[model samples]
Target: MAGVPEGPEAEMLAPNLAYQEGFGRVFLVCAAGRTGERMRDAPRERLGDTPEQERGIVRDEPGETNRIRPARLAAVEED
Candidate 1:
């Protein structure tokens, strides 16, 4: 998962490993209000998934991510 490193021990390396192994695309979770522990744990939880499951998890995340649009962009689109 592509969580920004929030603390010193955050598990950024796992995503790089996942990418190298071709399990799925980089999982970019939104780190809006999450703590380092949660961010680190999220990717680790998915480590057990098959590639297909990983793909679905990664694919579905973006829909939730997309809902957090900027107000200015939303206003512009309305215009």
Candidate 2:
């Protein structure tokens, strides 16, 4: 089960629930505010990267575009 408790209520109370057999992952998606800033890095490994990551940059970026290019395409010469 996915438990999502936000703000102070979740921060103060969520830990008390404890992670044993029954409790699944407690995913807290809080507002990106002061409270969220304080909670940052509480579980770095578990949270992965911030939500800002991979948000705006399009897949068609010139730099990133060629990285995925197929090498076999160049081998096919046109008539």
Candidate 3:
């Protein structure tokens, strides 16, 4: 899950859906704010940069490579 908001809605819905689908792990990639703050409840290992950032490629394990290209953030301003 990416950019999912941090609140009761995400807290309640995400785990339930993951459980129903029998997902062993649920990876949430949210911004560094409320979501990051709330994630303390779970055991987490944080990365320095987000996956889409230019320096976000991680090769921790010998054969495991997580390569993600940089992506632009899309937003709309209220007029």
lDDT top scorer: 1
| TM-score of every prediction relative to native | 0.58, 0.21, 0.22
Q: Output the TM-score of candidate 3.
A: 0.22
User: Which is the better candidate, 2 or 3, if ranked by TM-score?
Assistant: 3
What lDDT score is found at residue 46 in candidate 2?
Answer: 29
Give the whole-model CA lDDT for all candidates, comma-separated: 0.67, 0.40, 0.39
Candidate 2 C-alpha lDDT tens digits along 1-79:
3677677656645443442112244433322233553554343322343334323222224344454344435655441
**What is the lDDT, from 0 to 100, of the residue 65 in candidate 3?**
19
What is the TM-score (0 to 1) of candidate 1?
Answer: 0.58
- Candidate 1, residues 1-79, lDDT tens digits: the string is 5855654544567655665466635656766578877776767667777878877767877776676657647889999
Give the Å shift of residue 27 in candidate 1: 2.8
Candidate ranking (lDDT, best to worst): 1, 2, 3
Off by over 4 Å in 3: 1-6, 23-79
lDDT of 3 by residue, 1-79 (tens): 7878677657655554543344333444432344534554332333223445312322332223122222222223322
User: Which candidate's TM-score is highest?
Assistant: 1
Clashes of 3: 0
Backbone clash count, each prediction separately: 1, 0, 0
